[model samples]
Target: MKVGYEFSKESCEDPVMKGELLLLSSVMFLLYVVSGCPERCHCHSFSKSVDCSQQGLVEIPSDLPPQTLTLHLQDNEIHQLPAFAFRSVPQLITLNLSNNSLSTLDPGAFHGLQHLKVLNLTQNSLHSLENRLFHSLPQLRELDLSSNNISHLPTSLDKPWENLTVFAVQQNQLQQLDRTLLESMPSVRLLFLKNNLWKCNCHLLGLKLWMEKFIYKGGVTDGITCASPDTWRGKDLLKIPHELYQPCPSPPDQVPSPAPQPGSARGAAPSLPEDRSALAECELKAKPRPANLRYAIATFIVTAVVCGIVGLMMLVATIYGCAYAAVTAQGHGGPLAPTNQPGKTAGKELLDSPAA
Candidate 1:
C-alpha cells in the first residue's frame, strides 16, 4: 500500500514539471516572434540592443524597439526625412544619417532628442538651411555638414548651438560669411571653410580687421579666393593680405578746401582731407609703417660704394697701361739711332739687341 502511494505522487510531480517546461518554451518562441525584425531590414538583436544600418532603407522604419538608442541609417536612398522620424527614440545619443539624399531639413525635424549629440549629415545634397531649423536641439554638438552643396548662412543668426564645438562646413558653395555670425559663437573653435567660393569684398573688411585686431587667424587662407565681379576671379584674397574696407581715400591730385562754415575750426570739419587723414592714421596704426628715407639713403650709399670700387679698378688698369707704355718707349729709345753698319737696319738692330 505504501509503495503504491509513493509511485502515484511521483507520477503527478513528473507531469507538472513537463507541463511547466512546455509553457516556458512556448513563451520564449512568442517573444522571439514579436521582437525580431522583419526580413527587409538586416537586423541583429542581442539581449536588448539592435543594429539596423546600411539596409537600403528608403525611409525611417516603423516597429523598431523603443529602447534602441543607437540608430545608424547611413548610405541609403532616404530622400525626405519626416519631422518625427526620430521622435520615438528618446534614449538615442548618436544618430548617423550620412551619405543619403537629404536635400532640405524642415524646421523642427530633430525634436524630442534632448540628450542627442554628434549628428553627422555629411555627404548629402543639402543646399540651404533655415535659421531656426536647429532651434530645438539646443544640446546638440559636433555637427558635420561637409561635402554638401550649402551656399548661404543666416545673417542674423544669434542662437547658442549649446555646447557646440568643431563645426565643419567644408566643400560647400558658401560665397560670403558675415563676420557677425562668429560673434555669438564664442565657444566655437576650429572652423573649416576650405574648398568654397568665398566672395571677398568691402563687407569682408570686417573679417580682415577682426582677424588682425585679436591676433587670431583663419584656416582658409590661400583657399579663400574671390568669386564674383569678373575682376577678382581666380585671385586669392589673402595673398595681398591688405585691408579692403577702409575709409575712402581722397584723390591724389585733389587739394583740400576750407570748411563751408566761416569760423569753424579744423576739429569740427569733416572734409575729404580729414577723412583721408583719419584713414591714413588708421592704416598706419593697423599695419606696420614702411621704412622711411633712411632705407633709401642706405641703399644709395651701397650703390655708390659699388660704383666707386668699379671705378678704382678701371683707374688701376689705366695706370698699369700707362706704365707699360712708358717702359716700351724707354726700351726702343730712338730706335737705336740708325745702326752704323749698312748691313743691319734700325728695327733689326733693336730687335737683335741683348734686352730684346
Candidate 2:
C-alpha cells in the first residue's frame, strides 16, 4: 500500500512538471520573438504591428519580421527606396512613410508587398513616378500622395487598380491628369485635387469630361483651379464651358504624306486637292486665339449691342410719350379755354345786374 501511494504521487508530479515546462517554453518563445524585432522598433506580438517612426532611419531596415502586417516609418530621414525594399515583410498590409525626405524610388521598391492595402507617402519630394512602380500592389486601396512636388501622373499604368478607392494628389505642382490613368482605377470614389497648377486647355479637356462622369457617379473631389492661359486663371476647370474647348486643334492623323517621288518636279503643286485643303484647315485652326477669350469678347459685344438697342427703344418711347402728352394738352386746352371764358363773362354779368 505504501509503494502504491508513492508511485501515484510521483506520477502526478511528473505531469505537473511537464505542464510547467511547456508554459516556460512558450514564454521563452514569446521573448525570442519580441527580441527579434529590429533595433529602434517596437513590435506588438498579438497585432503584428511594428513601429519604427521617428527613428531617423536613413534607409529601410532589412530585418523586418516576416509576419509583420503593419509598419510605421513616418517622420524619418529616409531619402530613397531601393528595389524590393519590403520583400522581407511580404505580408505588410499598412505602410506609413509620410513626412520622409524620399525623393527617389526604384521601380520595384514595392515588389513583394502583395497584401499591402494602404500606403501613405504624403510630404515627400517625389517629382515623378514610373509607370510600373505600382504594378505589384494589386490590392492597394488607399494611396496618399498629397503635399508632394509631383508634376504629372503616369499617362498609363501597367495594370488597372480595380480595388483602389481613395487617391490624393492635392497641393502638388500637377498641371494635368491623364484621363486614362483615372479610368484605370474604376473603383476610385474619392479624389483630392485642390491647389494644383491646373492648365485648363485642350490638354485638360479629357479630365474635365471624365470628372463630370465621376461626379455623376457619386465620386467626390475638390475644385481644380486653372493656373495658365491668362484668360482661364483662377477659374475652375470643371466650370469652363465645353464650347471653350472646341477651338482646340484636333490631333493630326499619323498617316504620313507620301514623300514626293525621287526627282518629282520640285515645288510642284500637291497632286491631291485634299492635301491642300487639310493644310489650310490646320493653319486656320492653329492661328485662332483662345476660344474662351473670343467667346468672352463676343458675349461682351452682344451684350453691349443689346443694351444700346434697349436704351434707344426706351429713349424713343420717352420722346413719343412726351410728344403725345404735349399734343393731348394742346387739343384739350383749346376746348377748356372757351368754356372758362363763358363762365367768367356770365359771373361778371350777374354781378352787374345785382348792382343795378
Candidate 3:
C-alpha cells in the first residue's frame, strides 16, 4: 500500500513540475528577446515588427532581429544610406523611412531585401536618386516619394519592374516629366502627381499625350495645374487642349538624300505610315464635328426664316398703315373738295396748305 501511494503521488507531481518548467521556459525566452532588442526601438518577435521612428537616428540601428518583417524608421535624422544597409534583413517586407532627412542613397542600398514590398521615402531631401538604387528590387510593389525635392528621375526607371504598382511623387519640384519615364512602370496602377512645376510648353506635348492615354486606359489621377508659361498656369493639365502645345517633330521616313530634284526635293522623300499619321496629327487637331456643323446650319436657317417673317410683316403693316391713312383722309374730306386749281390733287393742296 505504501509503494502504490508513493507511485501515485510521484506521477501527479511529475505533471505539475512539467507545467511549471514550461511556464519558466516561456518567461526566460521573453526576457531574452527583450534584452536582445535594439536600443531606442521596440521589437515584437511575435509580430516581427521593429519601430524605431522619431528617435533622431542618424543611421540604421544595428542588431535588428533577423526575422524582422516590418521596420518603421521614419522621422529620423538620417542623411545618407550606404549600400546594402539592409542586407541582413532578407525577409523585410515594409520599410517606412518617410519624413527622414535622407538626401542620397547608395546604388546598392537595397541589395538583399528581395522580399521587401513597400518603400516609403516621402518628405525627404532627395533631389535625385541613384539609378541602381531601385534597380533590382524584385518584390517591390509601392514606392512613395511625395513632398520631396526631386526635379528629375533616372532613365533606369524606364526599365520595367513587374510587381511595382503605386508610385506617388506628388508635391515635388518637377518642371517636366517624360512619358517614357512613366512608361517604365508598366504595372503601376496609381500615379499621384498633383502639385509640381509643370512647364507647359512644346516640351510638355509628350506629357499631354500620356495624360490622354492614361485617362483613356481608366487610370485615376487628380487634376495637375500648370505652374509656368503663364498661358497655361492654373489650368488643369488634362483639360488643356492638345492643340495648345506645339506638335512633336516627325521622324523622316527616309533620310532626305539628294537623289531628288531641287525645288520638289522635300516631297520626293517617301513617307512612312507613322510619318503620315504624325503629319495628320500635327494638323490642327481641332476637328470639325458634323453635329456642330448641323447645329450651325439649323440655327442659320431658323434665324433667316424668323427675320424674313419679321421683315414681311413690317412691310405689310407699313403699306396697310399708309393706305388706311390716305383713305381716312380722303373720306373725312367729304368727296375731295373740288380744287379751284386744275391738274392739282386736293390731297396735294391739303398737304401744301399750312394746317390743313
Candidate 4:
C-alpha cells in the first residue's frame, strides 16, 4: 500500500515538472522576441518617430518613450483592446489596426488618444461596432471600416465623430442603407459603398437615387449582382439610372406611393417588354449583316456546279460521237490506211529481188 502511494505521488510530480518546463520554454521564447525592445516598454523604434504598434503584446506595457508617433498594430492576434493602451503615446497620429483578430473594442479604447486623426480598422472580423467606441476621438477625420463582417451601420452613430470626412464601408454585408444613417453624418465627402450586397428593391430606392445624384456610386464591378429577385437579379446597379425606376400607380383608397424615392420615380411604369424590344431593335440595326459575302459564296457555288456539269456532258458527247463516227465509217467501208502502194509494196519488193 505504501509503495502504490509513493508511485502515485511520483506520477503527480512528473506532470508538475512537465508543466513547469512548458512555462519556462514559453518565457524563453518571449524573452527572445522582446530582447530588442525599445528603450521604453512594449515600444520598438525604427527612427525618432516610427514605432511598432502591436508586436505580440499581450497587454499594454508600462510606458512608451516620448518620441513614438505613428503606431502600426495591423495584422496581429489582439483579441481585446485595453482602455489605457495608448495613454502615454499621445503623439500618435495614425493608428492602423487592420487585419487583426480583434473581436471587441472596449468603450474606453481610445480614451487618451486626443491627437489621433486617421484610424484604419479595415479587414477585421468585427461583427458589430459600438456606437460610443469613437466618442473620445473627436479629431478623427478618416474612419475606414471596409472588409468587415458588419451587416449594417448603427443608426444611433449620428454624432459619434463630428469631423469625419471619409467614411469607407465597402465590402460589407449591408443590404440597404438607411437615410437616417446618412443624415447623422457631418457632411461626408468620400463615401465608399462598393462590393456590398445591396438589395436593389423599392425600399432601397432612396439610397440609389442619392448615389446617382452624388455620383458616389456603389458596386465595384458588374459582378456586384443583386441580392433580391422581386425586381433585380443579374443586374448591375452602380448609380440608379433615371429610366429604370418608374413608379407604379397607387389606388385611390391606398396611400400614395412614397413620393419619388432616391432610386425610384413618381411617374407611370413603362412596359419592360417595350424597353427590351426597343433595345433589341436598336442592337439589330446597329450591326450590319454579311449579306454580300453570302451572295458571293452562292454565286461561286452555282457557277462551279454549272461548269462541272457542262464539262461532263461535253466529255460524254465527244466519246459517244467518236464511237458513232467510227461505227458509221466501218459500216460504209473500212477507212483505208494512208499508204503509198500499201498492198503492192510487199509484192514490189519481191519483184525487185527477182530482178536483182
Candidate 5:
C-alpha cells in the first residue's frame, strides 16, 4: 500500500516538471527573437513589424527579423541601395523609404521581396532607375515616385507589372512618357501625372491616344498639361486636336546601308553586321523632329487666312449686285421716262399731219 502511494505522487510531479520546462523554453525563444532585432529598430513580435524611421540610418540594417512583414525606414539619410538589400526579409509587405537621399539603386535592390505590396519612395533624389529594378517584386501593387528628378523612364521593362494598381509620378522633369510602359500595367486603375514638363509634340501623340482609351475604360488621371512649344503650353494633352500630329513626317522606309570600309573585299559580307543592325534600330526609335510643330502651326494659320479671304469676297459681290439692282429699278419707275416718251410721239404726229 505504501509503495503504490509513492508511485502515484511521482507521476503527478513528473507532469508538472514537464510543463515548467516547456514554459521556460518558450520564454527563452521569445527573448532570442527580441534580441535578434537591430539595436536601433523596435520589433513587435505580435504584429511582425519593424520601426527604424527617423533614426538617421545611413545604411540598411543587416540583422532584420525574418518574419518581419512591415518595415518603416523613412526619413533616413541613406544615399544608395546595394543589390539584394532586403533578401533577409523576404516576407516584407509594406516598405516606406520616403524622404531619403537615395539617388542610386542597383538592379537587384528589391530582390527577394516576392510578397511586397506597397512601396513609397517619394521626396527622394532619384534621377534614374535601372532596368528590371523591380523585377523581383512580382506582387507589388502601389508605387509612389512623386517629387523626384527623373527625366525619363526605362524604354523597356524586363518584366511587366501585371498586378500594379496605382502609380503616381507627379512633379518630375519628364518631357514625355513611353506608351509601352503604361501598356505593361494592364491592371492599373489610377495614374497621377500632374505638374510635369510635358512636351506636347509628335512624340507625345501616342501617349495621348492611349490615355483616351484608358480613360474610356474607367481609368483616372489628373491630366497632363504641356509646358513647352509656346503654342501648346498650358493646354491639356488630351484636349490637343489630332490634326496637330498630321504634319509630322512619316518614318523612313529603311535605313541606308553603310558605305563599305576601305580595303575591304568587295563581295565579302560585312564584318560588323551587328553594329549596323543596332544603328538601324536606334534610328527607328528616334522621335520625330520638334520643328514639325512649327510646320503644323504655319499650315493652320495659312488655311484660316484663305478661308477668311474667300468669305470676304463673297460678301462684297452680294452687296454690289444688290446696289446695282436698286439703282436700275429707281430710274425705270421714275415719272421722267413716261413724260419723255409721250412728248416725242406727239411731236412726230403733228409734223406728219401738217399740209403747209
Candidate 6:
C-alpha cells in the first residue's frame, strides 16, 4: 500500500514539472525573436517597427536597422539633435520623438532622409528650429509640435514642404503667424492652432482672410481664439466681424500692373507716391518678416499698449482734479466766470478774476 501511494504522488509531480519546462522553452523562444532589438528596445521585423519608448535614452540608438520604417523614441531624455542623426536610415518613414528634451536642431539634422514622411516633435523644449533642419526631406508630410516653447516660426517655412498635410502647433507661445507661411503650405488640410496667444489686431487681418479662404476650401482649424486687444480677446478669430478689418488692403499680386511711362494717362495711378507706398507696405505685409523684426515689432506694440493705458489714467486723473477744484471754488463763493452779455472783458475774455 505504501509503495502505491508513493507512485501516485510521483505521477502527479511529473506532469507539473513538464508543464513548467514547456513554459520556460516558450519564453526563451520569444526572447530569441526579440534579440534583433537593442537592450531596451523591441524590434519587430515583420511589422518594421522599433519601439524604444521610455527607455531613458540620452541619445538615439546606434544599432537601429536600416529597414526600420516606424521608429519610436518618445519619452526619452535626448536633447539637441545632432546633424545627420538619421543619415543611415533612409528607409525610415515615421519617427516619433515626442516628449523628449530637444531644444535646438542642427541645420542638417535630417539630411538625406528622403523617405521620411511623418515626424513627431511634440512636448519638447524647442524655442526655435533651424531653418534648414529638414532640407533633404522631400517626402515629409506631417509635423507635430503641439506643446513647446516655440514663440516664432522658422523663416524657411515660407517655402518648401510640399507634401505636408497636417501641421499641429497648438498650445505654443505664438502671438502671430505670417500669412505667407500658410500660403506656402498649399497642401495642408488640417491645422491645429488652439490655445495659442494669438493677438488679433490689424496684424492679424491677413491671417483672417487666409482663414476665410481656407474655410471655403474645406480646410480645418481648431479654435484660433484671440488673447489680446482687450476687445477681441477670447474671441474666435474666424467669427470676428469683417467690418473690424474695415478698408482691408489687398496684397499686391505677383502679376505686376503695367507701369505708366512719363506721358501715359491711364496707367499713372500706380506711379503716385501714395500708391507706391501702399503697394510696398502691402508687399512687405504679405511676406514673412524676419524673426528678429517680428519680435521687435511685437515688443513695441506691447510697450505702446502699456504706455497708452498709463497715459489715459493720468489724463483722467488730471481732468477730475481740475473739475473738483472748479466745483470747490464755486461752493466757497469764489470768482465765477464773467457773464458774456456785453459786460466787462466780454470781448477780451476774462482779463482778471470775476466777482461771485
Every model's Cα RMSD, please?
A: 17.7, 17.0, 14.3, 25.2, 13.7, 20.0
Alpha-carbon runs more than 4 Å astray in model 1:
1-51, 156-160, 209-242, 246-356
Between prediction 2 and prediction 6, the one with superior TM-score is 2
Candidate 3, pairs of clashing residues = none
Task: Please list the residue runs of candidate 3 whose C-alpha ends up more than 4 Å from where it truly belongs after superposition.
Answer: 1-35, 158-160, 248-356
Q: What's model 3's lDDT at 191?
A: 81
Tens-digit lDDT track for model 6 on 1-356?
99999999999999999999999888867765554467899987678889999999998887776778999999999997788897656799999999999997888888878888999999999887766777677887999988998999864454447788998999999988878778878899999999888877666778889989998999998858988867777889888766555443556554376666776686356643445435534211222334687889999999999999999999999999999989987897885655655765555466554756
lDDT per residue as tens, model 3, 211-264 = 778878877777578887676679887777765565655545433434565666
Candidates sorted on lDDT, descending: 2, 5, 6, 3, 1, 4
- Candidate 4, residue 146: Cα displacement in angstroms equals 1.5
lDDT of each: 0.68, 0.86, 0.80, 0.67, 0.85, 0.81
Give the CA lDDT, 0 to 100, for residue 75 in model 3. Answer: 90
Model 1: lDDT of residue 121: 90
Query: Global lDDT for candidate 6?
Result: 0.81
Task: Report the poorest 10 consecutive residues by lDDT, candidate 2.
Answer: 279-288
* Candidate No. with top TM-score: 2
What lDDT, from 0 to 1, does candidate 1 have? Answer: 0.68
| Per-residue lDDT over 1-356 for candidate 2, one digit per residue giving the tens place of the 0 to 100 score | 99999999999999999999999989968875754788899988779899999999999988887888999999999999999999889899999999999999999999988899999999999999888899999899999999999997897774537899999999999987989999988999999999988877777888999999999999999969988877888988888777667544543453356678888898785465555435323211123445597889999999999999999999999999998877887887643344557888798678889554
**Model 1 TM-score on a 0 to 1 scale:** 0.55
| Superposed model 4: Cα runs more than 4 Å off | 1-50, 58-62, 216-225, 238-356
- Compared with the true structure, what per-residue lDDT tens digits does model 1 show for residues 61-156? 776656566677788888877686777666667778889899967676777777777788999999988777667666676778889999987764
Q: Extract clashing residue pairs from model 5.
A: none
Q: How far is candidate 5 from the true structure (C-alpha RMSD, Å)?
A: 13.7
**TM-score of each prediction:** 0.55, 0.66, 0.65, 0.50, 0.65, 0.60
Give the Å shift of residue 55 in candidate 1.
2.2
Tens digits of per-residue lDDT, candidate 4, 1-356, equal 99999999999999999999999989866754553344333444444343445466545444455446676667666777878677867777788788777767787888878778899989877877777788778778889999998886666565656677778888888876776666566556677777777776544656666555454433221223466544565566653454554453343335333345466555855333434333322110112334688899999999999999999999999999999988887987886445777687777678878554
Model 6 CA deviation exceeding 4 Å by range: 1-36, 156-159, 246-356
Clashes of 4: 4
Measured on C-alpha atoms, candidate 5 has an lDDT of 0.85
